[model samples]
Target chain A: MNVGELIERLNRIGALRYEDWRAWVIEESGNSNPTREDVNAAALAWLKDKADGSIWLDPEEEQMLGEFLENVVPKHFDGSVVDALAFLERYGPEIASKDVADLKTYLNSPTGLAMIEKFNGHTGEQIGEMSHFFQQESNQDLSGYQVLRELEGPESVGNTSGSLLAAVTGIMPQQPDTAASAAPAPEAAHAQSAPPALMA
Target chain B: MQELPLAQTHELELIVDRRNRAVLLHRGPELEDYLWAQFDPEHNGLTLFTEKGEPRNLGLAIPKSFSDKLARASTLKLISVSERLHAGRPRQISLLQTTEAFS
Candidate 1:
């Protein structure tokens, strides 16, 4: 969509934020706030700049690295274009003969360890602790009643309190009978109403 | 339409993961919001967050309940709940899943 149409749609959905607009302009054009007349021209200029490799380190390398990470790596290991660019910025010159083992060696270094720690709040040792906790939890079986209790709605808090009161006072709450309260399906209702001869 | 900024006109699409029952919203390339069912293994209790990143309650009931039904399916489109429910809230979040979603 054109810029005008796009803006109207965003406003309708309440997704527009002033800060976001400002950031986009600053990134696209060096201008913090372009005049209304100049905004469209700035955008077109930004598009042209993006097409050439002026913003990124090298557009060709960026695309190649991004594609390799996305296609060859496991789905979970695949990262954003920003992530790829960051990697290239650090190791572009170091990537001699494009050896995978060299990259693996770099990952084992102190810098890589720090990056991994930042990825999650876990070190190599803490991840083990987390795995153990999940392993123990997964082994425990949940009873059907327990599952239902877990699934109870917000209104059940009051209902549970009322039931506790009834238990203490030796008076039963006006609860519907479990069997009788169950509603039959339409097909079942039709079958039940059929004559005995028809059933035979 | 009047000339508006690109950021102003961006649309957000919401989806729910079939497995793990996480709610995800996408606006542009970045800005992914995840709402998920968090089960406390220690207490055997369940708590669902309405949105990811500094979780806060949107004061809606159905999103918590419907999160269970969204399990084991492809990402379904999440439609906003009633606007009246979100009227006074600062963020104006609508949190409910629609029957239709993209596979």
Candidate 2:
């Protein structure tokens, strides 16, 4: 199932599901067929909402959703694959209970990949072609992950810089008086103060 | 003055000399001293020095109501706006206060 279908099926029985997620999608986003990108954006928005305590979230369902995303979704976001641990670490604050990494091997075997392709909404012909590509190439010395690693070396490094961490990371922290040897920090300093709490 | 907590507090000090040149000093956690500031009177621009002497000015502007305070105040104590909003002073103008109290 695509993320949209997974969301629908999950809401049906109420376990491992986002209750009222469809209404929220329609009312707030006007998106009936949520794509992977949409789901990613929604998850980020939900995290902010959860932080604001404006929404109620069950721990079990959150863990289930996190796991489903980890297992089924490709790390490719914005046309790239980041390190798996980094991905988890990035989202860990939002998803507090899930262990994003799995020790189980062979989860992405040909059949499993075919299921993932279905989840990705691939046509039968695309799924068949992807399976052949996976087996024929994967049966060699390197796994599919290793192949991706070789292809996206620079992005996987995630060498974002420009702050104090830049000094430590060897990106050369910006000198206020000297020419900037590195790019300005990718983000402003983490906000020092928490938002004020107010009654809704 | 921004009071440093006795325990975990670090000190970043600004001292304006009689000649009207100001220098910021900081005793890092390791208790090592470093000079950390520069002011451009022509442009009314102020940039802080990184440990490496890089200039960092975030383009903060001081309103006249507050900027005027630096000309005469002999000694000033600062608390965050959240802590004491009615008496808050712009931190950038802090070093411009009359005859440095900590000099």
Q: Model 2, range B1-103, lDDT digits (tens) per residue? A: 5322211232222222232222222222332111223334433333444345454542323223222322332221111112111111112112222123223
TM-score of 1: 0.20
lDDT of 2 by residue, A1-200 (tens): 23333333333432221212322444457874454345445644554454343334355445544554444334322321122222222222333332323311223556534433432335322211223343222222221212211221111001122222211111222222222212222322222232222112
- The docking category that best describes candidate 1 is incorrect
Error of 2 at B81 (Å): 60
Q: CAPRI band of model 2? A: incorrect
- Tens-place lDDT digits, model 1, residues A109-186: 787545433332243222112233332222112211111122222111111222321221122222222211011111
Interface Cα RMSD for all candidates?
Answer: 19.5, 25.2
* TM-score of model 1's chain A: 0.21
Name the DockQ score for candidate 1: 0.03
